[model samples]
Target: MIDWARLQGVYGPAHDVPTLLQAAGNGAKEAWDELWIQLWHQGNTCDAGIAALPALASLAQHTNRAVRFPAIELAGEIVGAGLREGRPLEKMKELHQPVAMLSALADGWLSERPAGYRVCFRAKLALDGFPVLSDVLDDFLDFCCDVSCPQCSDKVSIVIGDFGCYSSIRDWNLGDVHPIPLRPAAPDDLQDAAQGLHHAAIRDEQPRLAWGLRHVFGDAECGTCDTAFSVLSALEAKRSPSTEFQENAGAATAPAGHDEGKNRHWPAPPF
Candidate 1:
């Protein structure tokens, strides 16, 4: 006895909102895509999802929080992904557009009126990444950092310059007896640090060194560092203990002619 038409009217032009809401719960790819398309094409709506954001975010605050969590997360994912995809900024002229939407979503996540601190932190990072969007960044960060959202101060921290250096700074401040040098790593050292950072980030660990490099050296080096880390991690995994054991077993069982090393003085294996 669900009134489908009434439900669609209540949600918006796209009766798909409820479907998307449900899909988010189940991790339905289609539902996610639909939601992304709506937010991405926010230009199609007069209010740009502003009116509906609050209600949608409220669902995340329910007693059964899981039911609403996905919906709330999807909201941020859509916007963040859209921006990352390099959507044309001309389509979103209002300086406060994405910021406002994101602020509301963050508010719902925090279970209170949206504090602008986290939003401003994200906005600053986003702006730092996309300088062309400077005006929007300025307005959004300003609004979010306003006095009303003082709670943001507790939630956000700023680290300036090169990801690797920043990581080093944080480590140093943490009372590490011997902190990694604060300057950019030497070319080879940078390569090694980059590799380390990549593995750390992939493993969902903090890539302090990598972050410092990115924050200091800029995107190109940061990307190189990530690539190096990925390649190194893969190589290391390929040579893991089990893999080494299998290779050694194969060598030990080789035919007589392959006994070249068997007659020589063999060094003891490290392990």
Candidate 2:
């Protein structure tokens, strides 16, 4: 329902509005990717994305949380980005409409709508990690503990400044953390660790994720790691801090380490 003509991006106009709507309705990943790239060019302006807001907003109807959360998140990111870019003629123009549109949608969805669109809207924005991520600190930490994207460091091109996942890990650990040089120790490996921690002894005491992270280092908790399997339980379960950082990223500042600064040692904070 958005007047696509009102918005403009680096490209002329959003020509694929109808196609994108149909594609997203069908849960097309291509549509999602294209929309993200166009609207939030790696966390920037959203000429096309701004225009596509109405169609994207309608996605609250999506039954799939995985798909719906990410899509709605894209809308949140646009607003967050605009907020950060406050002032400056060009940035303001780029953000104004999308931010306003988001508000309008929230009002409409909250009052006359079903139990869907407005459900996770604000929460999703919070989790996006726009300003900071201390709330979902547990989730972000868990994700860092689990996954290792080596490819994240491969951005050697001039235009492509690849200082994202890997950089965040570095800052969080204060350059002391790096994935425990495990040859095959990726996210799945940590999942195995998580599985081991799921014994009857600690089963009732910790979140399911905390139980799995008990032995994240190897056969046991890494002694150097300040993040005890027990500590993670202080927060909610299944939180992936690293992934949260990736999901709702705008700030370069790292969140408070789940280890509470006791574990200044490398990758140990995530353990």
Candidate 3:
């Protein structure tokens, strides 16, 4: 039994957490909204968030689809926060079994729901202990974000949507000042976490997400200074203090006969 009163959340005490979670399990939307704000406001997880993992996992495992999906997502976010703050889940012995349970549930769900690829993939990354990459790919749907150039401190906007995958410095009055196209990694060139995620997307029939992963793990040049850098490296450097993903770029150069021509026609179910 958890003494919620002794633990702290974003608020002073976590006494209300149990009640909120109970309400959430019963499909109370307000309870979910309040719990999200209190336990994980703006991606910052609290002690209460960690303490509530088992309950969240139980809800995710037994509840109806409406509650299960968000429950798992919230649990994943909470787990990811530990790593983002330089605390890997491996060190938190209390959470090991709960995380393992969630991972097993997610693995089973992924095979049945290819349409929920992004959400499922994020949970997979979190369960696999990659907080930074999971967080960066959270915006995979939007397919755009601004990263300050480490070389010249210029704001470079990266676009990885249907229009194309490329980096550019945008001027509101001028538009796409010096656009540089992204060099997507070939399937064989993707390494480690990138390769795993791409393969999962492809296997799950999320071709669009799989294609985007190539660019995400590929290389790009700074639009302003022409300095070449790994796109994944630049993105990782900008998001968190972790440089662990730098090695996820695979080989430095794309192989001689890489082809992106087969990267079209996304037939996955729409979210």
Candidate 4:
């Protein structure tokens, strides 16, 4: 049993955490917002966040996906933060079952075809213990990521959306006029987390995401130096990329978009 008064949250003593959780479970968005601020602030988590795992799982179990989402997502964030902060292995071990349960809940939510696929993907990554990769999923959702050119050190954005998949300098007025089209990797060539993400996008019928995955895992060149680089590598250099997440994530099943006894192809981009 967790002693709320003894556990510290971002604000101070966590006595109000239970009340917040109850309100969140009762469909109060304000409570969930407050919980996010108190339990997870700018990627930092607290003892109260860790202590709330079991209760968060219960809250998810009893609510609709909208209400349930914040519960499971918060649990993921807490677990991910714990992993990233190098918390004691035994303490993490104690959380194993709850994390696994939240993971299952995330998968169930995904199967239900929620409004946001990226959020589901993020939750899955966090629950899978890949904190860095989970956070990077936000980049995919935004359809662009700012990265520095490996050769010239010029800042550029990799746009992967209806506008098209390419790299270009940040131009507010002109807007991507000097675009360097990205060369997307074929499904057969994809590996690691990229492969798994592509597979999930295909399976879930999110063609825009699938199309974006190709470019995300594909090749690019600097608009400044005209030097070539991998899009994935540039993104990784922006933060501490999780190598373990890469090596293990590739065990994903082969592309399932193939029609029986017929040819299959990458989904057409939404653009």
- After superposing candidate 3, which stretches have Cα over 4 Å from the reference? 1-3, 16-34, 63-67, 85-90, 114-117, 129-142, 240-271
lDDT of 1 by residue, 124-191 (tens): 23322322121122211101110011222111111222111111111213321111222333334444
Best-performing candidate as measured by TM-score: 3
**Model 4 weakest lDDT span, ten residues long:** 248-257
TM-score of each: 0.28, 0.38, 0.70, 0.65
Q: Go through the candidates in order and give each one's C-alpha lDDT.
A: 0.33, 0.40, 0.72, 0.71
Rank by TM-score (best first): 3, 4, 2, 1
Off by over 4 Å in 1: 1-14, 19-55, 58-63, 88-101, 104-271
Tens-place lDDT per residue, model 2, 230-261, is: 22331223344334444533333333342335
Model 3: how far residue 186 lies from native, Å: 2.5
- What's the TM for model 2? 0.38
All-Cα superposition RMSD per candidate:
19.0, 14.9, 7.9, 9.7
**Given candidate 3, what's the lDDT at residue 44?**
81
Residue 190 of model 4: what lDDT? 80
Cα deviation of 168, candidate 3, in Å? 2.6
Candidate 4 wrong stretches, greater than 4 Å: 1-4, 16-34, 41-44, 58-67, 77-91, 116-118, 128-142, 170-178, 189-194, 225-227, 239-271
